[model samples]
Target chain A: MKFVGVTSCPTGIAHTYMAAESLEQAAKDAGHEMIVETQGSAGSDPIPQSVIDAADAVVFAHDLPVKDAARFAGKPTIDVGVKRAISDGPGLIAQAAAAAADFKANPAKAAAAAAAAPTGGLATKVDSSASLGTQVRQWLMTGVSYMIPFVAAGGILIALGFMLATFALGKDGPVLITAYDINLPKDVAHSIMDSFNPLSLTWWAALLFRVGVAAFGFLVPALSGFIAYAIADRPGLVPGFVGGAIASTTGAGFLGGLVTGILAGLVARWISRWKVAKGVRGIMPVVVTPLLSTLIVGGLFIVVLGRPIKALMDALTNGLNGLGGGSLVILGLILGAMMGFDLGGPVNKVAYTFATTGLATVGLATDAVQYKIMAAVMAAGMVAPLALALATQLRPKLFTEPEQENGKAAWLLGASFISEGAIPFAASDPARIIPASLVGSSITGALCMAFGATSPAPHGGIWVSLLFGNIFGFLIALIVGVVVMAAIVIALKSRDHSLAAANA
Target chain B: MSLISESQVILDLDYPDRHQATRALAETLVADGRCTDLDLFLSDVRKREEQMATGLPGGIGIPHARSGGITTPSLVFGRSRNGIDWGAEDGPATLIFLIAAPDGGGDAHLAILAKLARKLMRKDFRQSLSDAATAAEVVEIVEREVVNA
Candidate 1:
């Protein structure tokens, strides 16, 4: 018998490959041949078409919904939890072989419905009774993941615009578009009001800056709208977006966006649950739900939530601006610790979201303090993975072959500022690894803040180091952090080695 | 000449805890000429233990290492009369498999680990090891289940 399989898990790290290995071994044990595809966080290895075409059956061992699942239709299938595949692979293979024979015998009814290419949104919803906090975290993560590309694109472009503008037109250069004057120094001045004109350097810089700012304008709305969509799905989008726009207009910022998004979702969900007539239910999602939810959320924001939220935003901005030497460094230390503590988990997301919101707060305003926070967060996040990679390289005998392999990947991931690359190491040895990351990151955060390292871009790690004000100081902080983390992890691990010697 | 021999197996062993059991296993490897330095070999094993708890379900503990101290790929099996804590949340581990492999060996070390891992998943393999009355009997079961697995 021949079988093809796909295995995936939500985290997509250890379990995916473990299941694949288990299944392949089990198939071989059952006197069959198998080819398995692992869909993991590191990505996947594509299976060949010939192998899939010749397979007697397909097995999907996954926790999350499989991507491109429609391709496996019409085949005799056995879909089970990843744990089942790992624990009882031979049993699953036996069942699949039997199911394949059944499919061959009865091809008409089973093949007809199963063979049709399913339209994209066919996901089997996992109906676990998740806690409130878990559900909210999932929704928030969904919004953050969606908003990252926008943040990266807008932030980098804006930084590039400023750099180009400064180079092309010095401090004494003429303004392309004044508050009221239409006629500009460049020939492309007329295009400002008319949409776009890329004739002159000054005009191009202005165009890039303006376009970047326009994309950034979607940041808050996208965050809030998606948060609501995650909770209540499509019907919550309109109200959530409108509420977010209002929050931005009212100077309420990210906090207000979060509140409005959740409010919109809850309101939409409540409305959907109402026992309406069949005809009314048809239009409820399109008409009644959107209309009522938008009106209520919008009105509440304007009449009630707007003033207090604005006041809170003002206080937060003032508090951040007022922080000086010690307080500022302390803030940096806390943010750094949070980022390093969880890698890319909820705690890390909080610090990142805080830094991004801080950037948004100073919309087009060049604030050194705001940039310092962003710089600290990025540097701290970058240190953990890089330090671990260095440790693995330094002491090859101390780590497993698999760990040494992970270290090579961590080098690029750390440089790209992806702290999550350190997740596999941390998961294996949380006791030592996490504390090492936390201490190193805290030091980086403190140093970056103390030295007043300012970054225009919120992310892009070492790649965008040139865009920062105190680039030398940033590099020093990062280097010092890596040294501290690598030394600490090596020391801790070696101490365990010494303890074992003593026991022996 | 299999990975596990009668001299490597300890039946009805009296060990207070994980530390003692680990030490005893390391000493056995050194005494059997499977390992060069007990200190270095035990150090690597303990480091691996600290990294991961090494406790498996069904009252099993597998503390494994690939180190420069190892002279040959070896399996040290110890069946405790009273179970010792190997960091399993449920209870202590009665059956312990200490796998020692050379640091610079070919894929032979990984192959041993893979075979051991697959056999450890089977209830009957674990039960057979537990039901064995003597050290030689324990070695025989491991030689059949894991050495040729």
Candidate 2:
């Protein structure tokens, strides 16, 4: 007998590969030849089509729906949880082998056997008991993942645009204070030297700046559209995008984007649950759901929600600007806690977008308040991974071999300002790791703000310290944060090990 | 050459500890022409053990390396009837698979190790190995599951 298997999990880290190992062992023990594929966070090594075609049966041990499931349409298969593949691998292989034999003996039995296999075979059942907070977080993460490319591409282009614009100015010119200030002075711009030459360095720089601004314009709608798609699939998209456009038009910013996205998603979801006839249901997804949801969400945003949200947004901007030293530190602390709370998750995205939006509108190079927020956000973001790398080095015995290897990479990732480097540790032991990250990051954010540090650039972590108004203060904040985070994480891990030993 | 041979199989070996077990396996690999130098292989294995404990669930220890001392890819299977400490949090290992490969073997070594590691995940495979009546039956099981199958 021959079989093929795929193992996948939600986080796509440890569980996926662990299950693959188990499945391979079980097939060999059952005296059946097999090839196993792992679909993990690092991506997949897809099995060859020839192997799939030759296989008698297939096994799918997954938490999320397997990608490209249609490839195994007619095959006799078994699907189970990833955990089952790890603990009961032999038994699962035996079951698959038996099914394979039955199909060979009688091909007609394939469909019936597949139907009788289990409930989670193709479309898995949802756990109704899962908390609301957990569900919201998952949906928010889906939106944020889709929104990141826009941020990276747009923000980097805008930074490059400004850098080039500054270079075009003669040494006698004063530093370009703002993006808008990049337009050549009236006399030069009207001169025949500038008019006859459309591809001047200043013109090219302005073009780059405008294109980057256009891409940034899509950020809110993308976030809103995807958030709704996560909730109600295709039907939610139009309403979510329209609602988000209204939010941006009304000056509600990122906070308004969040409200409209969740509202649009819930509304679309509620509409999807309606008990319509089969004929109507077919057309509902195509026409009815989108039209009605868009009308409702768009109308609500424009009429009822727009002014109130705008007022709230205005109050928020004023509050941030008016904050005294103590209150500014507190605000920084809050933003920092949010950034590390989930490590590149929805919470982190919220803090990031908050800072980036401020950079976009508040004249980052000139506005001290705006640049200080950016400094605090980047410093807090860098702390999680840097602290984790430090913790692994301080107590290597506390971590697994893979984690220690990850630590070596985290050093560069953290320095370059990538918080996602710490995600593996957080995913492994969320209860302990998250709290430690939060406590340390909050302290870092508070200290950075208190030091009155500022940054012109939106990204680049510790390497961008030269851009900071107070480089010494920025370094002090980062070092203090790294030390605190490392200390907390090490302490937590030690306690966990002792408790495990005691239990044993 | 094949990764494993009948001569390298150690059925019901009585090793007092993990160090002795590792040393006994290294000697067999050298004798079978699978390893170039006994001392180098032993040191490489010891260095790997220090990096991480190889003891897995199901009473198995897979001490593996891709070292300069290896002449060819090889697997040395040892059945320790009394069990020896493999640094597993669960308990000692009754089955030890000493995996070695040439330093330049690259993905080939990982491919073979992955194949063997997957099979060791099965309780039935471990149970059959433990209850094998003779060294020949043990070799048959390893050949079918770890090498050919």
Candidate 3:
């Protein structure tokens, strides 16, 4: 058998390379050909795609997520920590060989696992060795990750709807138009179905607004359902969605959705793992698990948890409504710092989710605190990438070849509000880049809050400026952040005495 | 220019803890003139160790650093009669390799480390190190297995 693998440890110096050697030696003794990639601080010499394609089995011994793991999707895999490979190399190799044989014996089972596995580009290793907090973050991130596109679509559509309605009715458009059931029959109009006029701005505006509302309706359920999916795969989906829908109906908002997601996922997972007869086992996931879990979770939410959660949501809403002057600036500072901290990591996602989830309650009032938060987050997010790009442009010699190239692409990415465009620059020199980012973003966040820039759209950055109120304030905040961050980065890099080498 | 030499090998390196053992190994590199500043290199090694313990499951600890204090790519071999706790889950490490690489210019020592790293995992390679009678013999083994690999 041919085996291909990757080995990485936290420090990425000693254990990573040793694990690769040990695995290689063990495979050789078993008369199997093996290729191992060692991902160390010095960097990795990645195994060829052809070698991975030819391999019957794979061994991933890493404390970190295997970079580009989806490449080996359908292969028989043995995943463990680097220490395990070093200690029991022979055992892991034997397991890999066994897994390969198992695949050949039952190809159908392997296919089923592959089909159900979340091996998309968002693949993250929920390392059993990681702390409970880390594990929970990974799970929550999976749900938030899937929930993003929904928010983007719904938020933008709604913003456009509001925009068109305002344009059509001048100022009284939304209030008057919303009172009438756009779907209901009234004389000869969209209510008349076949009499729909494409050129009628008022009619089109009302239609877009209603469709946007329909999309917003799915927001909470999707968040809860996907969170549950992260925990227990497909079996958790039914209860998760049920729990989310109940939360939405109860007016419990995102807090309720979060609770229901975890509850449903846990209950479903527990039920699926119960010891049962062979016949019972076959019906377990399909009939028993979802049924029992949904009953348990749904009852708890309605009778026990729903009221307290709704009250909490009310208190939160009131608190945000009362937030003024100083408190708002502090909140913006914290959220902005979090956004820049990890560059689209869990911290950034948490900040993003905080802003987007609040969008559910803001309802078309662009002056609401939720709208201001959305504005602040988007402004802060745009700063890092644009700053990195500006820094690279200002001093191209300070950055590496790859970073300079990334900077060129960052102009468009930053304009589009993709914070991840700065990740490459941060990854190479975190100590210098991260602090500069935090400082810049915090200032940007504070200034945006102070300026009272309100964003109607949850996303689209500068492109969705039509949905933003106080457009000049937003532009000023964004510009100030970019310049400050770029200046700080340059100052920090220039401080280092060994500036000649460039690579170092 | 060699990674490990006679001056860098200590047959009976006695120390209270891994910190002292690391300091002792780093002192040898300083004496060899491979490391320019003992404090800087030692601090760098400690910083790297703090990120993650450098202990391997077998009775081996490799403490390393890429520091401005290092003038050359150097390796020091230390054998402790009484093992020092290197924070491995299994047990204490008797064999310690302190690797110091230059801060800039190139990564010649990292290449040496990559080779030494692989060889250290083999049982025969480890057995040979423990069986070596003198510092010169141990240096010869490292040169053959790692430097010449």
Candidate 4:
């Protein structure tokens, strides 16, 4: 007997192919000819019509609705769920074959039975637990995609803004500045200062400028939440956004916003799977989910999470405002160590959040500790990918061709404070890479602290230099950290002659 | 009709390398009238393996040459019970089906390979094949599982 099958799933990743494999194997074992077409993210690749026409039976195994159902019109078709397709596809195929044989023997009875059978389609039967890595990757991918434009726009605009400011200041004749001064006439200086004054601009222009800045400030969290929503579906957006906003306002920082974004997205997704009413399905996704999620999440943040976060930020600010000599260096070391420990994982995010909040609260008040910590964290995070890339290049034999390819991309990403660029390395050998990155980052952080590095901007890499502060020390710290990491990797790899021999 | 003697050199190979494994198997089949040229058949099989890793999900690898590589349609069962590094993701491969067929023999070879893939996925069938020591025993199992289709 000949059998034809269609396999599909919603995500179109693992289950679809697994089911196809199971069914094909079953058919072969039963001494039956079979062909299976897979419908997935790559789209459908159906078995030829001729094959289907010659087949004794057809099986449709899918979670999503199968396309071109009409083609199987007179054929004995069994519609099963994706879970069944993966778990019991072979059994179903055997059953279909037996049924087909029975039908062939008693055509009139089989036709009558087929007419009486329900055609509402089968329900999915797989366990619904989302894995941790899958969840993390989903949220991270969304955040990364959304964060791209904001990072690009903000970095470019700020760079250009600094250039303009410098040019304007230069034209006005240099003042006798205390550090890194350029000579200029008094009248020119006055004109330069006046041009920079907010009041000098037209009211509308000033208002627009302020609005743009405000929007720029909020863009990161907003986009982060939206991206999380996209990953988790409609219900995730509201809570994600509200939680992000609260995180930002309460000084929980970008890390907190990220956490809230993921939490909200997951909650939204969970609610959607509650098997609610069909009549209210549309409303549940668009209206009820978002509204209820936002209220609950926003209220929680404001009442429970927000107050403690704000108090912590206030304490940190007060300490920086009243700090002595060695405190700045110590803070820098801690921040740098944290940033390097996990690259872009939770530890790194916590360090980043700390720096951003520190800068926001204390940088405006002539506090140097906040600047020191920010500089160190940013420097440490930037070093990880660059270090890994350099290590791969130095010891190419120790790594796979794919790893080498990823190394090239990592170089650019590392230089830009994109810690995620090191993910491929971590994924391939988390045990070795994570520890190595942490050590390198900590070294960089320590150097930054020792040198009293300062960066007004909370972000890192070359872009951090644009903010009003000393950049030379930050650059030195980053370079030193990356170099240290490279040396360690090379030394470790050199000792593994067996690995080299295998590659050869 | 059997094109080659069931006792031909197709089954008894214990080579270290992939090229050697193919050549040894091909030479056996050729000596038994399964094919005309061992070198040509081995080369064709090697070329196909180069195009993609033949490693299946389970510990099986089906390395087959196109019909042009053979003088006649034949199934060669080669077992490396000691385990050979077949570049499989799941490590070494224990079972191999070296299929050779006459030029333009339609999709019979593909159908056979597909059948073998399905049969190997079954725990009982795989275990039975693993336990089968003699070439005749293996042939009987394949004919029972696949030929009935």
Report how far residue A84 has shifted in candidate 3, in Å: 17
lDDT of 3 by residue, A232-315 (tens): 777778999999999999999888988998898888889888999998888998899999999998999999999999999999
Chain A of candidate 2 gets a TM-score of 0.71
Candidate 3 retains true contacts at a fraction of 0.44
Please give, for residues A1-504, the per-residue lDDT of candidate 2 as tens digits: 889988875434345666898787777776888877776544466564445777899999987777556557678888888767876788999989888888988887777766675543322112222367766876676666666677666765666566566667643111342334233567554333344356676655555565677677767777787777777676778888888877888888776777788888889989988999988988887788888898988888888888888898888777777888998899899999998898887789789878877765634434358778988989999999999999999899999776887787789889888998888788777898899899989888999999989875677777666556787887788889889989988888899899999999
**Better by DockQ, candidate 3 or 2:** 3
lDDT of 3 by residue, B63-102 (tens): 9877889988778899988888888888999898887777
Q: Give model 4's docking category.
A: incorrect
DockQ of each: 0.03, 0.08, 0.30, 0.05
Note the Cα lDDT for every prediction shown.
0.78, 0.76, 0.84, 0.64
Top candidate on lDDT is 3
Every candidate's fraction of true contacts kept comes to 0.00, 0.15, 0.44, 0.06
Give the best candidate by DockQ: 3
TM-score for each model: 0.64, 0.58, 0.67, 0.51
Ranked by lDDT, the better of candidates 1 and 3 is: 3
Runs of candidate 2 exceeding 4 Å displacement: A1-24, A27-60, A63-129, A167-201, A272-283, A362-365, A429-432, A462-468, A488-504, B1-149
Residue pair clashes in candidate 2: A25-B118, A25-B119
Q: Alpha carbon lDDT of residue A24, candidate 4?
A: 81
How many pairs of residues in model 2 come into backbone collision? 2
| Candidate 4 residue spans exceeding 4 A from truth | A1-152, A155-212, A219-232, A246-282, A299-305, A319-325, A357-359, A362-367, A458-460, A463-468, A498-504, B1-149
Q: Comparing only chain A of model 1 with the true chain A, what is the TM-score?
A: 0.78
Across residues B1-149, which tens digit of lDDT does each residue of candidate 2 receive? Answer: 26677777788767888888888887888775778788888887787678656676667787766578988778888988778888877788988888776765555444555566556666688888889877778778878886777
Worst 10 residues of 4 chain A by lDDT: A173-182
Better of 2 and 4 by DockQ: 2
* lDDT for each residue of candidate 1 in B41-121, tens digit (9 for 90 to 100): 888878767765666545778787767898877888888878988887668898988877776565455455545655666
